[model samples]
Target: MAINLAILGATGAVGQELLRLLEARALPLGELRLLASPRSAGRQLQFRGETRTVQAVSPESFEGIDVAIFSAGGGTSREWAPIAASKGACVIDNSSAWRMDPEVPLVVPECNLEAGRARPKGIIANPNCSTIQMVVALKPLHDAAGVKRVVVATYQAISGAGARAIEAFQEQCRAAANGEAVDPGPLKGQLAQNLLMHWSVDEASGYQEEELKMVHETRKILGDESIQVSPTAVRVPVLHAHSESLTIELGRPMDAAEARTLLAAAPGITLVDDFAAGAYPTPLTAAGTDPVYVGRIREDVGNPGGLQMWVVSDNLRKGAALNAVQIAEGLFA
Candidate 1:
C-alpha cells in the first residue's frame, strides 16, 4: 500500500525542499498533504505538475497520515508531533524538540537505523543540520580508528535560520554593493561580506545553543558516552550549505590514505579530496546536493592520532528536510 504523507511547515525553505525531493525520488504516495501555519494557509504550492493548496496545521491534520515529515520550528513540533503520533502517524521531526528524549531516537539512518526502529514515542528526531553531516563523515572513521575527541569549526549558511535570514543576507549584500548603510538587526551585525562566531544567542553557559547541540547530539548519535566534542558555530554570509572543519582524535594512529579509503566507502558520504588539483568540497559545491562531501583529509600536526577533514552539505536539504524524509522512507520501506 502507498504511504500517506504529510509535510508540516510546507511554506518554509526546508519544507519546500522536502516537496522537491519527494517529487525527485517519486516516492510511493497514496496522498500528499501540505500543512503550514495559519499565516500560510490558502497558499498554493506546486508538486509534480499539480498545485496543492496548503491547509493550516492542527492536531486533526494527522488523522490519516501514515508518515509526517516536520520541518517546522521546535514550537510547532512540540505542540503537534505527539498529537500526530497519538493518532498512529509516525513523525520524523526536524526540530531539536525531542532529540534528547530517551524514548525518541535521534536518527541519521546511515549511523543508527536500528535505534530508529526502537522509537517508543512513535517520533524520531532528526539531529541538528551541522550534526548530521559531521556524523555521517565521522562515523566510518570512528568505527575504523575509534574516535576519542572532536573539535569542529563551522561555516554555517543563513538558510539554517529559515527563509527570513536568507532574505536578510541578500538585502545586506545588495546594500553593501550599492555603498548604502544596512541595518543588521536580524543577525545583530553586518552579515554581508562578513563572518561572525556567534550563530545564535549564547546561553548562560557562554556557548551558543547551536554549538552545544553539536556537542551533545554527536555523542548521542555515536552512542559513545565518553567522546568529547567541542564546536564553534559561525554564521557565514552564504545562503546555503554548511561547512565544517573538524579535527578528530582517534584511539590509534591513522594514515591519511587509510582514512580516505574508509570515508569513501561510507554511505551518504562523497569524497572530494584533491588539494593538488585545487579540488576540495566547498559550501557552494555542496549546496543543492544530498550527500555529505568530505575533503582535506590529513593528519593533524599538533595531536598524535588526530586527523583533520572538511565536511560540507546543504543544511536545508540533507541537514533538515531530506534527512527527515529519508527517515520516513526507512520506516515505510
Candidate 2:
C-alpha cells in the first residue's frame, strides 16, 4: 500500500525543499497533502506536475495521513503534531518542540533508526539540522573509536532561518554591489557581508537556541550521556548549506588515516579531502546536495586523541526535510 503523506509548512524554505526531494525521490505516495498556515491556505504548489492547493493545518488534517513530515516551526508542531499522531499518523517533526521529550525519540536514521521505532508517542523528532549532519559523519568513528568529547563551530546559511532570511541576505548583497544602503530587517543586522556569532533565538543561558539544540541533540542521537558537546553557532552570509568545523576527542587513540577510512565507509557521508587539488567541501558545493560532506581530516595539534574535520550539508535537505523523509521511508521499508 502506498503511504498517504502530509507536508506541514508547505510554503516555507524547508517545506519547499521537502517538496523537491519528494519529487526527486519519487516517494510512493497514494495521496499527497500540502498543509500550511492560514495565511498560506488556498495557495497553489506544483508537485509531480500536479497543482495542489495548500490547506490550513488543523486537527482534522491528519484523518487519513499515514505519515506527516513537519517542517513548520516549533509552535505549529507543538500544537498539531500530537493531534496528527492521535489520528493514527506517524509524525516526523523537524522542530525543537518535542526533541528533548522522553516520549519522542530524537533520530538521525544513520545513527538511531531503532530509536525512531521505539517512540511510544507516535512522534519522532528530527535532530537539529547542524546536529544531524555532524552525527552522521561522527557516528561511525564514535562506534569504532569511542568519541569522548566534541567541539563544533558552525557556519550556518541564512536559509536556515527562512526564505525571508535568504531574501534579506540577497537584497543586502545586491544593495552593497550597487552602492546603496541596505536595511537588515528580518535578520536584525547586515547579513550579506558580515558574520554573526549568534545563530538562532538567544536564550537566557547566553547560548543561542540553535547551539543548545546541537549540544543536547547530539548527545541524544548518540545515546551517550557522558559525551561532552560544546557548540558555537554562527550565521554566515551563504544562501544554503551549513558547514561545521569539528574537533573530536576519542576514548581510544586513532590517527587521521584511520578516521578517514572509517568515515568513508559510513553511510550518507562524502569525503572531499584533497587539499592539494583545492578540493574541499564548501557551502556552495554542499547546496542542494543530500549527503553530508566531510573534509580536512587531520589530527588536532593540541590534543593527542583529538581529530579535526570539516562537515558541510544543505541545512534544508539532510538537516531538515530530507532527513525527515528518510525516517519516514525507513518506517515504510
Candidate 3:
C-alpha cells in the first residue's frame, strides 16, 4: 500500500539522507511532501527523477500525510510534531525533546520494535547517536548474560553537531595547513590537530549533556531502570561515524569467545574481532554503513563478570537517518 509521507527539516543532513533512502528503497509512498523553514522553502531536491520543491511547513502540512519524520531540532518538534500528530500523522521525531517523555516511545527498531506500536502522543522519539550503537550491541549480550553496569567512552564525530561544524573544521584545517592562526567555532579549540575530550558539562549532572543522554536513554531503551551506565562523550575531528570503548558488567560471567558467537549472530551487529591480523572496527570502516560494528572483545581484567569491547557505527546512518526510517516503517508493519 502506498502511504502519504511528509519529511520535516527537508534541508537538513538527516532529512536529505531520508529522502535518498526513500527513493532507493521499495517503501511504497502515495505522495511525498518536503518541508522546511521559509529560508529553505524554495530549494529543490531530486527524488525518483522528479524535482520536488520544499515547502514552508505549517499546521496544515500534516493534513493528509501518513508519517512525518522530523530532524529539524527540539523546538520544531516541540511546536510542530504534536500539531502534525493531531492531524492523524504518525510522527517519528529525531530530536531530544521527547525521548524521555513517559508517553513517547524512544525506539531503535532492532532493539525494541514492539515499543513503537503505541502512539498515545502520536510521536516516537529516536535515541541519541551514541546511545543507539551502544544499545544495539548491548541488547543481545544483555539478554544472554544480563547487563548490570556499563562504562562507555564515545569519540563522536563533528558531523554529529551538523553540517556547519564539519565546515568549520575544514576552514580551520585549511588555515592551519597554510600556517595561519584560526578561530574554530562550535569547538573549544583548533579541532584539526586537537580533541575536545571534555565536552561541555550539563549543569544538572556535571557530566556532558551528550553523556547524560547515553546514561538515561540506555536505561529507558533497555527497559531496565536498574541498569547503570557511565558515559564520557568527546568530540573528535572525524567527519563521520562515532566510536565507543565499552566495558559492560554482566550478572553472569561470559567469556569473550562466547560473547563473540552471540554478537556474530545478532541482528544489526557485525562482529569484527580478528585481533591477530590487525583487524578491528574503526570509524573509517563503519562510516556510511548501517550495521553496528563491534571488535576488541575481551574481558575486563578488573571485573570477572565484565566484558570489554569497542563499538563503532555511522553517526548519520544507524545513528540518525536509517534509524528514523526504520521507525517509520514499523508503523506500517
The lDDT of model 3 is 0.89
Per candidate, the number of residue pairs that clash is: 0, 0, 0
**TM-score computed on alpha carbons, candidate 3:** 0.97
lDDT of each: 0.90, 0.90, 0.89
User: For model 2, what is the alpha-carbon lDDT of residue 17?
Assistant: 95
What would you estimate as the lDDT of candidate 2?
0.90
Where does candidate 3 stray beyond 4 Å?
197-200
Residue clash pairs of candidate 3: none
**Poorly placed runs, candidate 2 (over 4 Å):** 200-204
Residue 276 displacement (Å), model 1: 0.9
TM-score of 2: 0.97
Give lDDT tens digits, candidate 3, residues 222-317.
999989998888888899999999999998999998999999989999988998889999999888778999999998899986899999999889
lDDT of 2 by residue, 80-190 (tens): 988999999999999899999999999888999888888798899999899999999989999997888899999998998888888878889999889899897788888
Candidate 3: 10-residue stretch with minimal lDDT: 197-206
Ranking by lDDT: 2, 1, 3
Report the C-alpha lDDT of model 1 over 1-333, residue by residue, as the tens digit.
699999999899898899889998856898899999999999999999999999999888899999998888899999999899998999999998999999999999899977888878899999999999999998999898788999999999988888877788888899999999987866767889898765565668789889999988998999998889988899898889999999989989998989999999999999999988998999898999899999999989988668999999999988998888778777785
- The list of candidate 1 runs beyond 4 A from truth reads 200-202
